[model samples]
Target chain A: MSSSEDSMCRAAVDEALQTVGGKWSYDVISRLYYGPQRFNQLRRALGGITVKSLTDALRQLERQGVVHREVIPTYPVNVEYSLTEKGRDFRAVLFQMRAWGEKWLPGEKDEKAEG
Target chain B: MSSSEDSMCRAAVDEALQTVGGKWSYDVISRLYYGPQRFNQLRRALGGITVKSLTDALRQLERQGVVHREVIPTYPVNVEYSLTEKGRDFRAVLFQMRAWGEKWLPGEKDEKAEG
Candidate 1:
């Protein structure tokens, strides 16, 4: 490939990584992939993630257009998060990564067997 | 998915990210996708990467079993780097990321037009 094409390819990959490569971004995206989730539901699902981190990740994802935030008119007002079209498209990359990991990385079961 | 299954999936994705998510690891892997490369060739291709960073990234990939290093005997011994089967498998993820980026992220051309 020409140097320009190489650079463009790198740029594109970098953009994808920057969008979902945060500490808690992937975790959030993975959960939301199931369905839309309320903030508390996401917090409980992620376990060990701080409220601030989850909020930050959500906001970043929202800004990147990978996630959509909706406010429901309720007693206390609930905010739900879900993947946008772009975010849904990211599932392919996530699936591929998971598949590669399963094939190459040793799981807890494998570790136990080796031990 | 069950909580256990979710955790396992997350762990797998995390493993893949940790292996290839270094600052220059993706760049290195991208260049090597074309073919095996000498150290200097990779350094030049990567552009702006320091020797130390490149060396560290290569060593990490090597340890992770994603890259293989071979010593070629010539007038002076020369070392070359190439991807292993596991590393080649990573192309799926890379291709997906690139596709997602092209679809979602704005390129320089887009920015120029907008400007």
Candidate 2:
């Protein structure tokens, strides 16, 4: 590829990677796709994730406009997160990825083994 | 979605995320897709990556069978990394992400401005 084309591809890919291909962003997006989930609820759904990691992930998604975060000014300040339209669009991509993974990278002997 | 379906989807999604949706793995993959690249070459291509982080990323891809590392039996023992066919399949995905980002998340005023 020409240097210019390559550079253009790199720029767009980098931006997209930073936006959605983040470490925990997809996981967080997957969790919120179902409905508006609260902070603790998201934390529990994404098991084994540290609080800081979850917070950072949420912040990144929020900044990208993929996540809708609503704060309920209640006794404890309940916060809920849901998917924006862009976020919902990723549902197809995520589902495709899930199918791809099961078909190609099924860690163990899925049903029948293949080399 | 049903609980069983959700669990299955989660499992497949998690496995896929671990496989290709890694932090710098796509960057590394993009660099290697053209041809075999040396470790230092990859570092420079993906500027600002720590040697340790690069090593860790490479190790992850190697473990998942996406990157194939070949050690050059030369005077200095140079090591080269390249992508497998399975890895090349993600080329389409990476390309799509680039297009998506250009349209949706272009950082600056992309060629034309949009709100």
Candidate 3:
């Protein structure tokens, strides 16, 4: 590849990584992939994520256009998060990642087998 | 899925991320994807990686079994880095990520078009 093409590839990879590189970003995204979720539901889904961290990750995902936030008009307003079209585009990538992890990594299943 | 399955999935994802979470880990892997590279060649290929950071990343990848370091016996011995089978398994994921970025992220190409 030409240097310019290489740089462009690098830039694209950089953008992709920025979306999911954080400690909780991918986990949050993974949960949202199941369907729309309320904040508490997301928090419950992702065990051990602090309220602040979850909020931060959601806001970041929202800004990146990978997530959509909706406010429901009810007795008490409820906010829900879901993947946008752009975000849903990541489903295949996430699936592949999970598949790779299971196939390649020394996972809990292997540990159980040895134990 | 069961909670045990969820945590196991999380653990696998964690391991995958551990291999490529850093600023330069993926880039380093990307470069090494083509073939084996000497340390200096790697340094040159990845623009602006500090020597210390490069060394640290290589050691980490080596420990994770994603990268193989080979010592060449010559008049002046040379060390080369290449992707192990485990590391090469990530090529598809990285390619998908690049495609996702190009399609979803407002990248340099889009900016250029807008400009």
Candidate 4:
């Protein structure tokens, strides 16, 4: 279904991994839940992403069923991206990952584990 | 902390990812949850994994306090691996990923989502 050539299963997992298996993916998608965002807006929200890396991530998510992209079609060519229904469904997973990550993934520790 | 030198956060996530992020990782860990498993047992349990990949995953998980490795030291040498408490904590997340993946991944879908 994608422009790239690969087996159906391999391609699908690869595509899904492209969205989920990375440092900043959940962070980026988590930010987009609020509303549609332009390219620059997303870069601003995701603090340390390089332009190329961010573009790659957004394109990958768009390929999956998770992201919806709208072309603003302005002079310089503006575009807005947001979550699709499937993408929105990932909100719960994202929250779980964040909480679990902060709990276990070093430095974000709350230190208030209930006794 | 265990022989790897990098930024602490980077090193930690890298170590955790070494345990979690891969093709056969979750499958291996999930299988170990049943009980302690020998090396050959794990290889047989995980149908598609190569020896190299399995060995690496086992070592990484061992380092992370997730997979406990007990050496039998028999004639040839035998090793058994099982999940630790922290590793067991990931059971819920693993179940979620498997279910969600089957639902949205390449295959493994249920027709009934309770409409």
Candidate 5:
């Protein structure tokens, strides 16, 4: 790529990283990728994540239009979190990265080999 | 995907993120993607990155087997860093993310819209 194109690519990647680059941001999105889940359910899904951090990550994703939060009022109030269309589309990036990780990263197989 | 598959995917992603998730790791790798560069050239390419942090990031990548470091014995000794085949394969992930960023991310066009 030309210098200009290279810079543009760099900027885009920078912005992309800014959006999903947090320690838990991409992982949180991956959890929601399966389907909508309650706040507590999401917390349960992502162990080792403090409630405050997960809340912040979800809110950040929501602000970026990558996640949607729905409130349901019943005898007991309910809130569900799911990916927006844009968020669903964002999965393509994660999917590619995950595939690359599986191939290059030391996974279960590697762990088994060493252990 | 099944529950077992989900966890596997998550592990893969977690490992992937660990490999490239640092604030400057991905950016550093991206700089090297164009071609091999001496330490200083890479430092120049990535503005605002501290020398120590870049060195640490490169060392981490080298440990992961993604980056190859070579020392040249010339009148002035020099060291060059290049991506191994595995590292080259990792670019596909960055390429996909870049494409997603340009589309969903607030880029030059978005900046112009605001300014």
Candidate 6:
């Protein structure tokens, strides 16, 4: 790539990272990728995440149009969260990261061998 | 993917992020993607980075085996930095990120339009 193109790519990558680079962002998104879930369900699925952290991550993702939040009226109002179309599209990046990680970063088996 | 598989992927992705997710890590790696460079050259290429930040980033990457550092034996010792084979392989993740960013994130043109 030309210098200008390289810079542009860098900026774009930075922007993407900024949007989804939070500590809990990937976990939240990955869970939602399976399907939508009630807020409580999501909270339960992501063990060890504080309520505040999950809330912040969901709100930030919603604001960025990467996540959708819906309120269902019932005896007790039910809130559901899911990946938006944009969020679903982000799977490519996640998949790529996973692939690279699998190749370069040692997994449990590799660690055992090393030990 | 199965739940077990998803969890494994998450672990791998997390490991990858932990290795390259530093504030300056991606910027440093992206700059080196083009080619190797001297310390000062890299520092200048990545404007706004403090010397300490660069030093820390390079050291961290080197420790992770993503970057290789070499010292030239000469009248004045010169140091050079380049990506390892593993680092070069990480371009796929970066490219995927760039594509996602281009699709979703607002660039300068988009910002101007909104303004």
| Candidate closest to the true structure, highest lDDT | 1
Candidates, ranked, DockQ = 1, 6, 3, 5, 2, 4
Q: DockQ, in order, for the candidates?
A: 0.72, 0.39, 0.67, 0.17, 0.62, 0.70
What is the DockQ of the complex in model 5?
0.62
- Please state how well chain A of candidate 2 matches the true chain A, as a TM-score: 0.76
Candidate 2: regions farther than 4 A off: A2-8, A18-24, A35-59, A69-81, A108-110, B19-24, B37-56, B71-80, B106-111
Chain A TM-score values for every predicted structure, listed in order = 0.87, 0.76, 0.85, 0.70, 0.80, 0.86
Best by DockQ: 1
- For model 2, the DockQ equals 0.39
Candidate 2 has an lDDT of 0.75
Q: Please list the residue runs of candidate 6 whose C-alpha ends up more than 4 Å from where it truly belongs after superposition.
A: A1-4, A107-115, B1-4, B107-115
Sorted on TM-score, best first, the list reads 1, 3, 6, 5, 4, 2
Q: State, as a TM-score between 0 and 1, how close model 2 is to the true structure.
A: 0.66
Please, what are the lDDT tens digits per residue for candidate 6 over residues B14-101?
A: 7667666888888889889879999999989888899999999999999878899999997699999999998998888888888888
- Kindly list the per-residue Cα lDDT of model 2 for residues B1-115, writing each as its tens digit: 6766666766765665666567777678878887999999999888779999899999999887778999999998999999877667666566666666566654544556744
Q: Could you give candidate 1's fraction of true interface contacts?
A: 0.67
Off by over 4 Å in 4: A1-16, A73-77, A106-115, B1-18, B73-77, B106-115
Better of 4 and 5 by TM-score: 5
Off by over 4 Å in 3: A107-115, B108-115
Whole-model Cα lDDT of every candidate shown, in order: 0.87, 0.75, 0.83, 0.65, 0.80, 0.85
Clashing pairs in 6: none
Superior candidate under DockQ, 1 versus 4: 1
The sequence of per-residue lDDT tens digits that candidate 4 reaches over residues B12-63 is: 3344444567666666776787789999899986767899999988887777
